[model samples]
Target: MRDPDLDELRAELEEFAQPEKKASRSPREERIIAGFEEIQRFVDEHGRAPRHGEDRDIFERLYAVRLDRIRKLEDCRTLLAPLDRQGLLSGAGTTADAGSDDMDEDELAAELGTINGFEITELRHVRPSAEKRAAEEIASRQRCEDFSKFKPLFQKVQEELDAGVRETRPFELKAEIRPGAWFIVGGQKAYVADMGEVFTNDQGRSDARLRVIFDNGTESNMLMRSLQRALNKDEAGRRITEPVAGPLFSDQHGDEDQASGTIYVLRSKSDLPLVAENRDLVHKIGVTNMSVEQRIAGARLQPTFLMADVEVVATYKLFNINRSRLEKLIHRIFDPARLDIEIRDRFGNPVVPREWFLVPLSAIDEAIRKIRDGTIAGYVYDPQSAQLVRRGTE
Candidate 1:
């Protein structure tokens, strides 16, 4: 009962709607493409092509090796040419190639499996939960998008370290994890850019998240507790102390200036053989808010005064500065000449006297003058020369 012309018209339309034939690739070809894509992802994330080196991450080394192999094979190059938007093939590979040319199908598969996501059972040696967390936290580092903004800061810090304006100390407490604080962990400088609001955890301990940026242009948002544990575990981890700043002394204290303390240079009057032999060179550098005479009273009764009366050789009044930090600075400057002699206190206990140095009064005066003018950071106390010389000269 149907018309032949109408049925013929529908068949024509269905024939025109058929999909086009697609190209087919074997499993080997598919695997090659997938591996190349992984290398491309690495380049995209790190802003550089992976290179072979002992210091590089394991996965990156594998990628470097695989890239070299792919470049050697004419077939792989032809297949990957269309996808080489990063011009990875055009660039030269690193000279530090490792391993043999025995990258068979099974070995390549194993390498690929070791990357991306990791399984606990795959680890050869099991680690504790905290250690595992710390490892994972460090491994999660990625290229920082705003690294250019921090490059200058890292350069400045390096300069300060070279000039003796900054010092590295053992990291011992969680209280040091504040914003703007810097540290050296895993052989890289880490700056604490920001920290989240403080909160107590189930263990009744305060904790917070930190945005830590690294000198290698990487960053991580690890927890404060996690960073603390990482620092404790890393042997090279250290806290970068803040550089000394502001004027150490002021004449005719202004109305707005707060009197901090005075830096007093004292020569010990101890009759010990070493002290008597080098009395002129044996001096105590101290900072105190109390009167110099009052602080030195009953010197013979105090172990810190070396159980001997002391003569105040010089004093420089300070304003609006941290007395303890200023004292630490002077102590560190003259630490090489520190008196190593030990004495017994009135209680019959052995006590080591600190703040006493074997430096001459002339050098101490020069250091005080440089410190007042903020040039002390560029100089150091040279025990051999018996003078304050430029830091690099010694």
Candidate 2:
């Protein structure tokens, strides 16, 4: 106890050792420490740091402000020194920080990478789920990356369509939908590029994800069910397929090939009051590819001819005619003046004749001429005037 030099040597050794660190902080330091810790917890939850952009949630913006103040405050930085495991403190108080005001809008957007150009300039839409899917199917379109491979296929398809080998039919619900199929949608021909996996929903309906490329330099990632719905709603939608037979129209030679169909106009002879009263105006019009005599042989036995004797009013030889199409056109032209006459057949059963019309033969002759001249489509039969007039004039 009397050794002063030895005690002084011991005290000097103690001073040379490292001092112990502070274990606690003051109230002011603790307040800043709590605020900074809250922000750190947010970063731990969301993979990125908080941002002050207007697109962010209000709570996120408030946390972003708190984080900014905490970073700039020296006391707060010192209080939370042990929590900086990701080196976030090194970049604090700089323009490169997440919530820094010195950063430009473009720079901040590039950092987040959330919105694209399409979403930025678009407005919101509300619709039914089926209609919404259809809208997205058309609206969310893009240029296909690998369309070069499909160029040749489209060219060949066009060639086949021109040659009459491939034709379009009405889109059906039960039709086979698969990859590499072509369909008419939104007035454009779309080709199914690839089909993804087949998935079933809660309702047990099957569907597939598809990449549909259009002729207008656009494409979409659509579902099979969506395509079906869109096509069913569209009046013009059709499926493109190659038929087994060859072209519908081909050049023919010789007199036998040049033979035209026979257009026979017959007047029905009936004892009924309605038929006898308008026998002169009511005429039964028919077209046949075979001989007119052979066609009239079964006229008396059939109910279509009123089951009575028939008078041959006029016969014109149709040249190079489509018999079925010609008959339909003739029926449509006289549809307005169709005569509603009923007569009892040989068995005394009441029957109505459908083909009899109370129209002038001259008008019928004029319609046939207009059809032959390729101008019938421009006209419509006016019931009031009992004459053919320009379609829009009516």
Candidate 3:
């Protein structure tokens, strides 16, 4: 048997469903009533309140329909009401209505609130495509996993930096300011720095300054050019510099061949201790499990330290670690080895012919922190299970 509330709601809907007998009701009012009946039918089928979940697509469509009805009803109200008092009827209309001016302000406000509440509720039902796109953009901006907490950490780092605390180590090296001798700093996907045109004065002395050139032809010269200037003062008057740029060698040959000599040149510089220090920090942060000593001892090891040439090396290393963790999660969730897995690119374009799953770095970091704090359930998928079973769900 249907519930008493459902029966009553059905009866109310039936009353509005019939043709209006009075002249007060118009075609717009009829359409509004029809829309209300549709909403009632949807509620009856769901047997619960509309909400955001896997079925968001349905929720949003219904919400938009409901809003359209409200708008039509508002339009009908405006047409029937007197010009001076029309605002009192629709609540949002701007008609001055001197007759309704004498009405209680509190009652008018309450009526306005009702309309606004309905409007806001409908707006919450955002389409999945738009929601997904917004989520991805937010994720990209926050490149790290723990974005929520990272803001404070980043602020603290910046504060320390402003107070002359060198959290980043700078590498010291002597390179003759010559043409085609560019040093790439940061990492494999390092943000490129511009090498400005070498300017020569009449005195025959070339002002050896490095300038960052953008695609727009604008330029920004390196502020602190010399290692002596960067390391002149340290904590308690001791000189300590952090490496922001790695070394690179370039010849007439392609960039790949140039990288070999660049690596060799960086490795031979034993006097500069920044590379070793950064390698140690990378291991300590758990981004890399291998120590510098172990890496040096390996059979595949070469004479050069390639770590010096990349720009923002430490940040990029962190980015890679985050990507690896996300890949593992995707593999576990879909179990590609067992099922027909399909992956797609950012634009929903087919990529790798396997199921693609993405978790924003910020979201992943926040999830990890929550798990540690015992605020949320933390689970990693097992490839053998081929199901989305929680870590302690047994």
Each candidate structure's TM-score, on Cα atoms with residue i matched to residue i, is 0.45, 0.37, 0.19
lDDT of each: 0.77, 0.66, 0.31
Cα shift from native, residue 79, model 1 (Å):
34
For residues 1-394, write the lDDT of model 3, one tens digit per residue.
7799999999999988968676676544554444444444444566432332211333333333343334466563454344322232343432222232211322222322323223322234344434432232111111333335334333433332332221233334333223222222311111113344555534453444443222222222342232123223222212122211122112234333212211110122222243334432221111223333343343222222221221221111111012233233323433433222233444555433222222223333443333223232234433354333355762
In the predicted model 2, the residue pairs found to clash are none
lDDT of 2 at 387: 78
lDDT of 3: 0.31
Off by over 4 Å in 3: 1-21, 49-55, 68-394
Model 2: lDDT of residue 339: 83
Residue 232 of model 1 has an lDDT of 93
List candidate 1 stretches off by more than 4 Å. 1-13, 16-247
Clashes of each: 0, 0, 26
Candidate 2: regions farther than 4 A off: 1-260
lDDT of 2 at 59: 38
